[model samples]
Target: MTEHPHVNIKRYRLIRTIVIVWMSVIVFAAFLLNIPRINILEHTARNLYFHVPMWFTMMGAVGVSAWHSVQVLRGGSIISDIRAAQAARVGAWFGVLGLATGIVWARFTWYVGSDIWWNFDPRQTMAALQLLIYGAYFVLRSALDDPEKRARLSAAYNLLAFSTVPFLLYVLPRQMASLHPGADGNPAFSEMTDPVMKLVFYPAVIGFIGLFWLLYTQRVRMSWLAYRIQGESKY
Candidate 1:
């Protein structure tokens, strides 16, 4: 068995403190900072801070997961396997949040009168499909019995999953007619967006991605410990 890897507890704690403080400030600014409201978005505009950041965080997490998966394939270490699995798990949660928030924002802003919760908007549809791809990755991992076989197989599968992200989330959505900002040749969250919103929007993205890192690292540490103590990696 490989020697258990050491996680930098000091670094984790420091980043944990910073993420907490940073996100606290972001939450305050997201609600309190006033700006010229658009006709439809009005107060729901604030959802931009929360909703968009979730997707950003998810994408960041996916990238981290995929990077470690690459390391797993190259070296076949349980360390990279644990990191990849936890990062993808946490990342999927963020994707779910992003989808939920988008649905709520649409209910108020896009579908005000009708009782329509989901209209199958192109971006929304693609986003859901993207989550399912990652979902399969997890299920694929759980079905395998051997750690080395699971690690190698899942790492290859993970690379395939990550490859779908850009096209599903960005490219395909832009090609279809949809209620989302970037549809049919339009840029996502760019045109008609207020400059002041960008101030909070950018930081919110950073904070949430930082938050993903914190959660991902915590899971990595736990998984690493479990592997050390139990002699196998779970999940």
Candidate 2:
């Protein structure tokens, strides 16, 4: 029942306010900002503001999770263990959102003509598989009774799970024939995408990552508080 030193009321309020305003402005620009549209993409191109950021935020969250997992192994602190677990959990939630949004975007843009919501695109398939790997980490933690053992085991699983993210999301899918951008022979933003769009794109990525940190930190605080009160490790 040790207190985590990172939790603070004033700092939390400040970050919450900043994230709220950042997201508000991003939403406004996502709809209002004018950007070039291609033939198939058309208006749905605006989804770049929402869809792309989910994955980027997920990446940021996973990276944070892995860092904390390393701390768990090195520092051997229960709070570090809590942080590592919560971060991975929140990161996985973002991954789900990213996959869901990608499906919807593809449904409209890539599979617009037929009754095909999913055609087993390699990017989609790989991303889903990546999520399943993280899901198993949660299930594995639940099965273990010892707190220290669970922390060490879960941290190892998280490290292995994170290693697959880049290959699944970026490398393996691109090696095959896929409808997603960044694939071989497909149109990429480097040449086709407008510069003005990037003005919004990069900030959207940062804003969503910050939003993930806010949510992650809140959960860490809650899990810590619950652990303190319940005297159990399974928060």
Candidate 3:
């Protein structure tokens, strides 16, 4: 079956506008809602709405890359390769945002009076290492001259590297003695019963996820367009 050409600019614009408005409203609500105090737990909780979304989005990007990797390995499709590369680019952006937001949260909640920048915390170290691994994937892609080889090798690397994300985001943090609270430990809100906080927090997550999808679609479309342009020049 032939694919339908259904690139509706109006629909894309409407969806984009809705996502932007939703994000703006969520941010405004987050700022206006008055919490009792700026204690360590409370301050850290604020970062949940921002930092956690970054990490989640990053994972989503990596997942896309992995799916494309599988497609390329199985079918040798250039579209899959293009998608994998685009996803890595987006994932890198989200990873950087996650790290920056984490740093800010760490400064306010963990390093209350200190100026030390690099702590040996497992969460910090593992997250940084994850970023470095993904960065290397880009470097490897640029270093290769053959498109087929680059695609295959990068796909392999993506699969291998993505395996670390779950460990870094979940396992490592839970295993080590860190300033950040573990999933099952104290300060963990596994059983949050507050209706007001839930109302705000759940929407914030959904809004941020929608924003991530909007950006990902735009980036992938641009990448596909660039690929088509390049291909046409040689035809």
Candidate 4:
């Protein structure tokens, strides 16, 4: 049997403390820093620090999930299976947050004065679909009777789901004219996107990704404990 990752209380506590403190600084800097003003983006530009990084965070989660799925398929590690499920669950949470934030940001900026919240933006539609795909992975896992079969099948499903994320979040959105950047010859970089924002923006991405890791590790521990107590998942 593949050895599961050993838990070190000291290490977990240290990492958790670092994540909390790092994100605290990021939140403070994201709001407090002054940035340049522009015609359409104006103050909403600050959202670049919060909204954009959420997708990045979700991407981080996707990477973790897919990595474990690959490991499970190759090594048949039950621990890898647990890790994949928890990562996907957390990743889906980030997708939900990213979608919700995008809607709010668009409502105030692009859809202001219009009675519309869901405008069927391609990225928006695809993101929701991606989350549903992950949701289906969990459902598929729960339905199977055998643990080994469930792990292998769900890992395969995760890989398939992971394949769609980049197309959904990046490639498809770039094909059409949209409110988001990187469309039409990669010219989204404009004067309004201040370089100063990167100070907070980059750190915010790192912080949120770190936060995802912290939560994921915690969930894995709990899931491992429950698995030890019961022969299978406890509902």
Candidate 5:
């Protein structure tokens, strides 16, 4: 196997350090920063820094996966295949975190007095369905034995799954009556957001996306190393 030219170890380490510090500051400010609080979204409003960014990071990861999947389909390179799979895996975890955070956030804010942890809110439901689609991509990979064939087939399935992300997370949810912000003609978080919150929100999004890239790159490196150690050059 050829040395990976694209991954710069020194640069990656530097950026990883930066991301660690950046996210630490973002988290500290998210909880400690004073901002105007709305009626229902009092203290829980701090979740905006964490929850919303998780989805943004997930979407960014999915985009990276789709891009590498295209590379796999175009050139059938094993390295690209490895990247696509790792990107999707990391991205899917972010999606799961986003859903979990949303659930906890809603439990306190929306369904505070009720025993409902989940009420099938349209946005939440669609997000869950979207994750299941990605889940199938992994299962499909496991079912196939040939590396090249698995890469090809799973890349195709991954593209199909990526196609539904926008609709499931954005379009369809906005069309339905939902408790989530930016649904059913409701104002988006951006529209009515305080400028103070945006200070932390934007950086949080960038930090989480950087985190996804870090994790995805690490997995790809490990996978490539494993293949090399096993005497499999074609991967």
Candidate 6:
């Protein structure tokens, strides 16, 4: 029963406080900001604040998961294994949130004409497929009987499947026709845009990122503590 070094109770409290303040700011900004009337149709670009941040935060979580998976494979430490598994779980949760938010945004922005609930947009399809792949990663981890074998196989699969995330999130979306705009080429903030939108958008991104980190770190700490307790009980 080895003690995990990274689990700190005080750090968790600090993260919780930061996330609460960040989320409060995002909510306040969303409510107070004046959404501009872009065309004859009023465009509530405010939704971008929430919608875009979800995807970014999800990607960040998944990236952390992938890194931890690699660490488990290479380091072969139980703490690393626990952290990786917890990271994957958290990342999967955020992935679901991102997909739901993206769908809602799409419905509001582009579902004006067609009765089809989901158009075969490359970005949307790829994002959905990515989520499914990670979901399977969790199921695979659960189905295995041997602990060491489970850790090895799950870590391998996690690293392999992680390659798809960047491709789906960045590459394919840029190459093909996507209803969602490409993030890489264009400036997120432009001088031409309304000052109020910029004010809200930047803070929303920060807030959501803070929220994601807070959750991920908390999950990691809790998982580490559980592993330590289980080991102690076995002795």
In model 3, state the lDDT of residue 12: 67
Q: Which portions of model 2 show Cα errors greater than 4 Å?
A: 1-4
Residue 171, candidate 3: how far off, in angstroms? 0.9
For 37-136, candidate 2 gives per-residue lDDT tens digits of: 7899998889988998998888888898999899887856888888888988999999999999999999988999887998998989999999999999
lDDT of 6 at 212: 73
The residue pairs in collision within model 5 are none
TM-scores of the models, in the given order?
0.95, 0.95, 0.86, 0.92, 0.95, 0.85
Clashing pairs in 3: none
Write model 6 residue lDDT over 1-235, tens digit each, in one string. 4444886667667878987987887888787777767652255566777777787777877788788788888856776777777767777787788788777667766675555568877778988999899989988888886777877898999998888888987887777766666634433336435777877788787887787777777777777667667762210
Candidate 1 local lDDT, 1-235, one digit each (tens): 3433557777778999999999999999988999887888898888889998999999999999999999999986788899899999999999999999899899988898897899988989999999999999999999998989999999999999999999999899989998888899655677777899999999999999989988888888788778867887554
Please, what are the lDDT tens digits per residue for candidate 5 over residues 23-90?
Answer: 89998999888999799899888899999999998999999999999999997677898899899999
Kindly give the stretch of ten consecutive residues in candidate 1 with the minimal lDDT sum: 1-10
What TM-score would you give candidate 5 relative to the actual structure? 0.95
> How do the residues 66-156 of candidate 3 rate in per-residue lDDT, one tens digit apiece?
9999889897677788778888788778889988888877886788679766686778888899999999999988888777888899899
Ranking by lDDT: 1, 5, 2, 4, 3, 6
lDDT per model, in order? 0.90, 0.88, 0.76, 0.84, 0.89, 0.75
Task: Tell me which residue pairs clash in candidate 6.
Answer: none
Give the 10-residue window scoring lowest on summed lDDT in candidate 6.
Answer: 183-192
Q: What is candidate 3's CA lDDT for residue 218?
A: 76
RMSD in order of candidates:
2.5, 2.0, 3.5, 2.9, 2.1, 3.7
Provide the lowest-lDDT 10-residue window in model 4.
Answer: 183-192
Candidate 2 TM-score, C-alpha based:
0.95
Give the poorly placed runs of model 6, Cα more than 4 Å off.
Answer: 1-5, 40-43, 183-196, 229-235
